[model samples]
Target: MMTNLQKASLFFLSFLMISIMACSRELSHDDNEEEIIFKEESSTGEPEHYQAVPNDLVLIYDGGAHRRIQWGKEHFAPYVSAEVNGEEKWLFDGFLFLEIHDGRGRGFASGYQAMAARKTEWENLLENYFAKGNGIHALNEQIEEMRKTGRVTGEFEKRKVVLCIPEPIPNQTDWGQLDGRSLQFFRKEDRIDACKWYIDFAEQLFQDANFEHVELVGFYWLAEEATNSRNLAKDVADYVYGKKYDFYWIPYFNSDGYSEWRNLGFNVPYYQPNYFFSESIPYSRLQEACDRARKFQMNMEIEFDDRALKNNGWGYRLTDYLDVYEKNGVFDSLKVAYYQGGDAFYKLSQSEEEADRALYRRIIHLITQRAEEGVD
Candidate 1:
């Protein structure tokens, strides 16, 4: 029964089969992982300096400007981040900065109030609405009610507005004329306390931003002609963020302090060279503006109105602005942003049916052609 040759043959066959099975298992595992490994090697797993893309080239259509257009759609998504009803809009690696409005720069005013020793009251006030949705406006309303009840009071209504158009509003000041004038009931010596308090309050907002759907890139600041708000922005940058964020502002080209804005740590300033107003000036002295921005390492923003492009009765067609940038060779040389929507494509297309779909295609073609040309 114990044949040595037969026993040896059986042992060899068993070993051979085991080896084949093991080899098959290893090959199958390798087949499953090849694509994943290749993708990982291509997309990530290496240290690299981040390069800003056309994504940085955003189209900012605010409530004051593009009131009608909803930007949370595919057609516009390629151009810029949309302001939607819910903050569910998805743009990979997107960012939003609410500035002093939602960020609560006013609550810090209590730090300079006569009851400087009382911290719990103001702390409780901000803690209630510090991180919630539309909390800043809610905070403002609550503060207003508190003022009515005679429990608290602070800055005048005019200073409460963190951001505004460059034009002065009537009835803002004791004298209707607005300039580098602020009426603080407090003595000048207490102002330092207010600034420090404001900076500390803003830091909390930045911390809370980590929990938001759109991460806060930087704290936006208003450079109103009256207050040197730019300096305030710098103080925040120097103190809280340590110049680690992309500081953004839209400066009127004709305004002073263009170069100084860069020095003040405004790394990402957007320029609206053309306006929707009567002038809507075409690019005549554009090189000077481009040079000014380039000197400080910045770029210009291009406007794309969804309003009736039929004749641009207000002035030149918005498309003309893009064309001008492309012709002048700054389309790619400078970081370009596509500012979209003062109106909807449907209204502007004036088509009987399928206006939106048609308008979308037209825009895509224009932008695609421009990109294909490789404006470098």
Candidate 2:
């Protein structure tokens, strides 16, 4: 009995209602199951989707020891992303250095004595820093919270944290000279005992439950005088093997006898030159060491002094070393070392506020660059 136009309109309305219902059903079905979000295909012209990934590498700087959390937030977190050929690629795998010094106020002469006296204070400091809801602990909690809220843009589920601890050099005479005669009076056994005490203390502090998610990386400073290659190597191996520690780094300045350390079985996974412009062990020598360590399947890390590249001597420039290393294919998975301390030349004369900004900018740049490039 309906007119032809009314019949046509009714039919169209029915079809549209059915289509909407079907679409709603499909969407409900999808919502019930686990969603697989894939990165947008390049051809799709959609924005690439980022997911939480585990952090595999941690690059700790020296700031954490002073109870400063601003560094991680303002400098480290924002710029760390991987890239390929100038395009954004992936996020960083691990954590960075957090400089903790045992012999903070102690002069060389009474270094051991001072550490002994300050042992209780050191433990207290560590407890507060790693305490729940504080310091690195708080930073980590915030990140985890972000993940839970689905706000984290990169892979956070698989990230692991690493703690970088720069060990004190026994003979940092430049700060305050240690008395040789006093040191000589102690027997070798006594000296070893003192060293062991400090190492044990450090290990205890690092292994505490408060540092639950952190892995330790020991940075052994090569002293030109007191710490010979053999001793350093032996100490490092003794300290790290079978411990909760993750890796070892041998900074290359004053490493005149590092070959001895290598020969003695101190297989360091990462090596950075302590100072720019210092002569590195020859390429052949380094290759030999790397090859030898390969029996144990060790990874080597090289760090370029970016500050040196900007200012220092021409020979210390990154361009010079990069060309050589790249030509030799030695930099396949290397990392560049950029310091953000007051030591950098540009920050030397700047006001405290300006210097701090410059320092952080340099750090952020280095971290972001490494993240983009997957630099080791």
Candidate 3:
């Protein structure tokens, strides 16, 4: 008995109800108090459509870190060098010098000692990177030596340095403020304050050291995972940006907040496959990591240890990283971070074994090729 218009309206209303129900799916968050609502297409619950907010939340001198960030494809460009008169530029490639935490547990035992230890460590690293007769300098020489014999042609610059920010352990009491009040890292604000102090202190060291062969382009977050310190990460990032320097992070695979690195305010986040150190992890993880990095618009990290320096059974692991990354086109397409376990690369460069030397040269070749590509 209904008219045609009424019938059409009823059908449209039914379809609208079904569509609204379809879009009502919710995403789970670790913090139960807040939730992110977005439209997703698949069962995997990845965002199909969402809003991205530009990171305009500036840190005031009064002090602060995380705010909303908009994700975009443009954020994932190859590492851009900050060049000035052919010297002192940014990083596309970097060597992670892990002097902040000496594995022997003999140094960096406390925030106060860390401060003193890092001063000496910076001197050694600068010397290694620039001073003649060091391993990194020798590697640079080899890069040029190979370049002269190859078809690849381009200019090379000093290696850009990224230093680590020591974590403010909660019990450390020596970290005092401008007001002479000692900071207790038990509170989040105190930890952030300590980080800001470290940045300021490191900047002073860099200015004083005045190394000409390399650039102090940025600082790295020492924590491998973000964990519950999202605000801490963001505040440090904002503070670093305020200083006009880049903030870098290399989150282990599937670590918390790794996918939302941009949102959390890290300028350059690299995905660590974590495959090199563990024998249980398969090579497939390297490709999987590449896929995840591409998905999240992040860079990649190449990990190797002392095992690669000799006839150790684990030497093949380094080769696996090289092969997988090469197959995935990571060398040509993305910025890379080198994680040579505590002086391993330097040892390799100084090795008397031909096999070890060959491995070192191969790495240099790939690095030169990357520089030639003008990956910006």
Question: How well is each residue in 99-216 modelled by candidate 1, as lDDT tens digits?
Answer: 1111222212111111121233233433433434333333333333433555222222210111111111111122111134452323332232333454456556546544322233
lDDT of each: 0.37, 0.37, 0.54
Error of 1 at 137 (Å): 16
Worst 10 residues of 2 by lDDT: 46-55
lDDT of 3 by residue, 103-197 (tens): 32222323222232233343343343333433334334443444455532345455455666755554444445545776776688888876786
The candidate with the higher lDDT, 1 or 3, is: 3
What local lDDT does model 2 show for residue 358? 47
Using all chains and alpha carbons, the TM-scores for the candidates as numbered come to: 0.46, 0.48, 0.62
**Model 3, 106: alpha-carbon shift in Å?**
7.6
- Tell me the lDDT of model 2 at 140: 57
Q: For every candidate structure, what is the RMSD over all alpha carbons to the true structure, in angstroms?
A: 27.6, 26.0, 18.0
Clash count list over all predictions: 0, 33, 5
Clashing pairs in 3: 52-70, 65-234, 65-235, 82-89, 82-90
lDDT of 3: 0.54
TM-score of 2: 0.48
- Return the candidate ranking by lDDT, descending: 3, 2, 1
Q: Model 1, residue 189: what's the lDDT?
A: 21
